[model samples]
Target: MRLQAEDGDEQAAIRAELEARAVAGTLQLDAILALSPAAPSSSEFDFLSALGPVQRQQALRRLLALLRNEEGLHVGDASRLADVSSPNFYRLRQLWRGRAKSGLGFLSGYAGRPTRQPRGVGALGTLGKLAAENSAFELADRSIRGLSKLIQEEQSARIPAYTLDAAARHLRQNARNMPDVLAARYGFRILIDYCAVSLVASGSDGSLKLVEIAWVIEETTQLILAARPVLDVGGCVGQQRATRAARWYIGRCGLDVPGPPAAWIKAVVPDPVSPLDRHHVDRMVSVAGEEHVATTGARRFGRLVTDVIGPILGRIKIIPRATLSENTSAANVRAFGRDILDHQSIRARVAQSVIAHNRPIIDMLRDSRLPLLDAGDRTGTMTSTLNDLLLRKG
Candidate 1:
């Protein structure tokens, strides 16, 4: 009975020693919890929990090294506490230092290759160069497969389709090889024209309605000044609408249109032979001048309109889709006009679109070394005369 009791006590002591060794080797959850109340619920904790025992041990050892560094514990003491060799402790310290230098990128799971020489970096570069060159020539043609084929044939490179597609999109959106001669030459003096876009509103009950869009462009700068939507009850825009639009544009821009002697405003319109059209133009000529208001034949005017405004308007997503449709009802038309086609709403959208389109032009103009035209100074005398007329009328 005495020998049996002694054996039982020896077994208990052995079990206690095993438990102490286990506790010494393992990370203290209570200590971690005391340090950070939210640690148990954090993503780092979850990641650690998801890892296998061996990986978990490695990660915990590194974490212990980091904590020891933070607490200003001695390296040798920290190594002993983590049950790691001095070499491993120094390596973990280096990893912690790397984390501090590279930010959270050091934790990213992309261990295949560095970004500078990624798995398909050569193929991606080849695709990007081809895409940029092609995008310059064909602004609208962006086919990823076609670009991949071209790169494969031209450079003997085999790039992944998704990689090529991503590269193509990046090139197409960012490439700016187009010449900015207009922006370089003309700062802001521009020409204005109106185009009637036929739309099938859901409320129009299958009937087509005309919405007039005014194209204000700087001829020399080739920069789109504005694409304003005119709310015209009449299907066609006449002299009154044109004059009003011009006046609104001038007022909004805070421009001083110099009188007859100096041509502050230069406009090219379709020649009008009819007495009524002539009368309308004569009034405008009085405001601008006969020299500034040149008239061209229908063919020439049509070509000019197409060349100047087609490309600019083609880039807009809303303009092209404004087509006739049988699904629209009269009530829908009224609602659309009130909600989407209202003067204020349309103007606001136009202003936003134009601002985006003009950014490059503005940048080019800012960087341009060309001499600017002194339109205001050249036409000061005419401006004074017009001011007098306004005062007299008032």
Candidate 2:
């Protein structure tokens, strides 16, 4: 009993001294870490070492705590402590995890992006790379690329990126703007009515041979706004394909959208570009001329364009479905022709052709515009074209 009291009193005194030091700011960052017991850690701190010892220690402590799931640590706080954006911080963490457990692991990998142009290096490389730099500018004013080109030619050093990004992203746009600009003269929406073009591959393995393209193009501007590839066919595949294409450009191109709570069939237009056959084309066109769009025998397959995707889509009157000779808009004619005939070539064909068609318009916007087919209301629903946009019909 006497020995136990003496030991307890000794432990209390030691703890008091430790607490006093902690209160006086003498605690080492290496102590009390959430990580596995340290085994002689290296002094290295990787890219963060540039933050200097004081800042780095603070960041490292917070990071280890956050990883430990300590009481109040959070992702945002962790990122701030590391003095990096959330994305960059995640990238750094991933790099760290792939290597040794030593703190010196930060001494390597993921050199930061270069801040300035490398003297004689070209202003840009591929469209994919260009898109990474400025998706918004690619989404807007086609002239932006021309401007970039001119700038590169005159002075190799390009303008600051944030300035350009802000200017492009802030451009005013709405569901009604496209109609006011492109369709005011025509007084109606122009939709691309067509089908799949079998891409001729050299090797001919027979997989992904038929590439159906559903794309949205801004007519007057000759801009293929958003495009997604549909590698398959039949049933409601076109519906999803069409809806995805529209969803990308709908709001961006001044057409508001979504579909498929219950898409009521209105018409089944044949692939004007490559119809299945003469008889099939004749039959479909004849049926399309009827009083109401037919939905007969539609049960076996998936949603039709008229139902799931077309209604929102059928309003892009920037181009006309009329004969190319009669279609006055050059942008419309270019897009229609590109869709019908230009998707050929053995190597780098589709991407290159698409790039040729829509160079300035970079990666497509991915915000949700339409609900997936039959996502809501089992009985189904319909939509109406409003100001070159589609609204759910009440």
Candidate 3:
């Protein structure tokens, strides 16, 4: 019995050691969890970029074939035909499926080891809309340099964890104090902040109602997961709304979801400046779908607010979606929707305001750069060239 007891203790020690390694990310899980590509089409693959010119083109073809024949594919035959190992074929297939983009990017000839990818600036794209929104109007006093610096700070804080290893390491370092919620990986970091919203009309008539805004954004896709406006004001409820939206976002399978978002969380970053605190961080982790909260360190709270969600939602023209809580019915919301949200004039004006930032931004120079634009009226290429550009980088 003593020997058995000793063996049991030894096994527990080994298991604990393994989990610790997993938390620190010494154990590689072949990186199955990654940012889901936000759209249907994609162009570049980092791995494919490493392949030789000929092999690169071949890889695309192989990936395309695998996608086409996923159901009836004889793994051995497919790999032999593609002249790649079974494991390689599987890996390619996994990557293609995970990104969920139609495997369609044709290789270009100018391949002298891409000098550098263009700087992808998603924050700057939303600049105009942000400037117009009351929620972010504080920037009116700041200089361009300050604005740029602030955007950089927000981006650094909201960077997506692409692999399980990256997520583990990030949570370990940043959230070590909050051991109760340490196991959870966030799809978005939510922030409980304030916004200047109009209670009577969607239109700004000089004065506006100030309400607590839940600025929740999925770092990976750089997309606002929920369309709803938050009516609640406290830390716990605001986080619940944000994470609940994230839960809905993650739970939703795209036309056909391949797997899950890397790290799978809808967490809110805490702000010392804002009245909202981290009281709800634990529940935020739980509802986002993790069972165990680590009991190691004090909960980590107090950080900068990422500025992506509020401005984007503000610029949507029509209020997207919101039902923060049943108890807080927000009679103002009802009147606001009826008076402005559902109005014919507002609906008609949507097309004009919809893609406020979708105007194509093409640049031209000498041999240093070549610029081109091939677009018809009302079809802005900004979404393809800019919106997805940053997401693809992530």
Candidate 4:
């Protein structure tokens, strides 16, 4: 019978042809049995496709032997048809009998390789919990040897480095298994950090350009509020541009000068600060209030840039290189930045990437039962205060 073209729906076609052949008394079972076991019918081929070659051949041979027996063939004749010795035929028959009693369980592929009940499953579970509770960036940065050593120290047992690596990979694949951020007393803090990212223009003479990116992250929620690309028209990021960006963001949040900052603003800037840069920091203080604005250490700051901000940007291909080199040209940087801003679709794409990255973290935060301040609630307070100040001016 000709097999139907559609997969998984050819059973009816096969059955109809078999019944028609049987009614016409033209169904030669012996001739069908004589066909090579290596080449199977469509249905049998589909069933054995997933099995290894040896297992597939063995399954077909056993099936042929069963069919011969059903035809009332003697054991010796069935053994000859199956191309097996008499003793081996009896052994196969015994195995098949047990499997048939279990409803043809032998067709489910190899019965070898006892079920994969992992040893030390409890230890692996604990390892996963430990890896998740710690920073994913930190865990990923650790060397396999280092991770193995740490695991041994923590668990007080010698576990293969490969095992620890697999556990870490599993944790990363399942984000929900990771630990949640602790809820802060005052809403969420925004951690602002600057990093240089490499980008190559889309042209024949496309050369690498180092673009500065400013990452604004909410602390308690662990959500990225913004990832604005800093445009340096003068070939280098200056205090004026950085400060202007900072001031604009703070103002947009409706925080007034000489008033309590809506969110704690901490910037991680480069070491050996210039007087002009110090002036920028002073300006941020005036806007965000003295207690809120502070600079983090260069080393700790570098970790945040490389581990967190760098990876997120890398995933979207916005940054060509994962880490920018020291000698990256600052020339024509503003042109690229201007291009990004002028193109509304490009801006929207970047915004979408930020939103996608934040969704999982937001869900995790919500699952933790942490109280999140509503955006409307915060905005209403700022708007009312600004209106009162405006009325006073009138």
User: What TM-score do all the candidates reach, one by one?
Assistant: 0.35, 0.24, 0.26, 0.39
Candidates ranked by lDDT, best first?
4, 1, 2, 3
| Candidate 4: segments with Cα more than 4 A from true spot | 1-124, 128-181, 201-208, 232-265, 270-278, 284-302, 307-349, 364-370, 379-394
What does candidate 4 score in Cα RMSD to the true structure?
A: 18.7
**Candidate 2 TM-score to native:** 0.24
For this target, which candidate reaches the highest lDDT against the unseen true structure?
4
Write down the TM-score for model 3. Answer: 0.26
Q: How should the candidates be ordered by TM-score, best one leading?
A: 4, 1, 3, 2
Better of 3 and 4 by TM-score: 4
lDDT of each: 0.42, 0.34, 0.32, 0.44
Candidate 1: stretches off by over 4 Å: 1-190, 198-208, 233-278, 283-302, 312-340, 370-394
Clashes of each: 12, 11, 13, 1
Q: Report the C-alpha lDDT of model 4 over 131-220, residue by residue, as the tens digit.
A: 657775565445444555565666756676546554443333233233442422223345656665433222224443444455655433
TM-score of 4: 0.39
In terms of lDDT, which candidate is stronger, 3 or 4?
A: 4
